[model samples]
Target: MAQRADISVTWERWQATPDGQTARLFHLTNRRGTRLTVSDWGATLTSFKLAMPNDNLRQLVLGCDTLEDYLQSPYLGATVGRYANRIRGAKFSVDGQQYKLIANEGENCLHGGEIGFAHQLWDAEIIESIPAVRFTLHSPDGDEGFPGNAIVTVTYTLSEDNNIRIDYEATVDKACPFNLTNHSYFNLDGVAGDVGNHVAQINANQYLPVDSESLPDGSPVSVEQTAFDFRTAKAFNQDWRKIVSDQRYRGFDHCFILDQNDGSQPVAQVRSGDEQVVLSLYTTSPAVQLYTGQYLEGTRGHNELVYQNRDGFCLETQYMPDQPNSDCAEECIVRPERPFKHSTTFAFHC
Candidate 1:
């Protein structure tokens, strides 16, 4: 782990809202020529710079200008948690006991309730370079209508192999539900427009469908007859716009139960236009939430302001949501004694 003082740490004030909430940006760059910009506001990774095979220059992640835009930008390279996805009814039962969570996403608790990990000022330190800058935060018992005081650590590592690896570890003092994921809206083509043209493939045969409120129901179903079949390279927009009338989301936003024999396996691989960019995902988490930026509103990224169902996408790695209260979970990860550890690496290639 990289230590706080080992790397050059610099801080800059981004902006302050009229309500007194302010956003601070922290820059952590290392001797390896890697640069990472994170905001204390949400423990959010505002910018990630990396070298491209085509050019010696570093590239900026999908990002927008302005603090309001930064805060509003759900995909501004941030690790969201406590519980990353939705829990049905804003309540779940664990160990025969009932617990009510903060209902932020309609009738459900989406992403650790309203003030999920994305909306916090995390305490951070650069662990002196074993290869990560660890961001730590304490989620007090019942902070978001959930239980337990959980200590969470999210480590960002820029490996020498040109891989950006994210390692998450958390431990709760009590039994509660927890799932974490990074909500980075990716536009492999640099926000030109619509991932409809990109080729993608997921190693999942079945996926969990949700009700109108985006809550997963019952067991995993085959993606066979539906537009969810992503077992091989398929265009995101090709099937995204073809969802039936009954589906609530305009685009894809569902969890695909992964076939993990040993955890941390390749769940999906994405290829951009012209095969200029290739991205692969590896995770230990039981599920991966594939979102096509269906509800992405406003401007950002390389080409133009992102519109609904426009540029950008997400592949979240984590356990099944609503697992705390439902038996529908493929794997219930939250435990009192075991240390919850999840590692996801995004390998970028030409």
Candidate 2:
């Protein structure tokens, strides 16, 4: 049986310095009888068990089994940084100098390269008043081939409003492009089944067109009558299979240009049945990457459960993918002055 949740919580010394690296785990619970388990190692949200309708509870996020999983999970539930998505050719001309990065995603530099924030150990602080856990990681100058000594802070604030707000703030000492996003593949149906029936709505009238490598090939085209439209709420599998022929994604990974943003407002919404978990993404960034995990089959885990495609989805808020050398020909690269910062609220309703 699952351990019964207690309103009172305690912090156990759960394997700090597991990989000869310092990290800590904190268990937080409020008076309402809900519980959240978090770890500073990769700043990953391990689990969120909340009370659901019919007096039942559920874990609404797809997570890993161990600390090592958090260290090597494609980017699961971690705050991905520096450059969140792919950069074409693993090279970008920054400040008149062509800077090269480690290419981990085939020919592209993906998710800050092979060793990103998701694999780093972070500094943790539990603020009692804020009733939240804040994880901090300092990315050294040129850590991921991106300039600047960036000091980043990711705060997981679980409010009484039943909102999990992930707030990011980063300031670089040098002029280098910075973009951050959370790679939490949410399965609001409680991490137990495929989310194909889940409904989603993005305020996007158009989406950036990409190539076979999942890299932007050109500008975004209008979704007016196309199948890329998500202007209204629609089922996940409705057009995804048809879109597989797009070749750009080869599946369901594309950046949607949101229509309902003044550059600072709610841009997308995701809902699940049985739990009614509503995820609203609000960002000051230009684009958001919507990826339906068509390749996340559970493989070689302790349970031997194969994670097939489309079990979860990711709504990564960022500038754009492969924008470093885009220059309007491909993607839009964000300048240095603007350090990436955005807030996404995951709310639940019974």
**lDDT scores for all predictions?**
0.72, 0.72
lDDT of 2 by residue, 113-139 (tens): 888887888888876656678888898
Q: What is every candidate's alpha-carbon RMSD to the true fold?
A: 3.3, 4.5
Q: Residue by residue across 50-76, what tens digits does model 1's lDDT show?
A: 556655434435665565676666646
Candidate 1: misplaced stretches above 4 Å? 1-34, 56-60, 246-250, 261-265, 299-308, 328-330
Best by TM-score: 2
Candidates in order, TM-scores: namely 0.87, 0.88
Global CA lDDT computed for model 2: 0.72
Query: Which window of 10 residues has the lowest lDDT sum in candidate 1?
Result: 301-310
- Candidate 1: C-alpha lDDT: 0.72
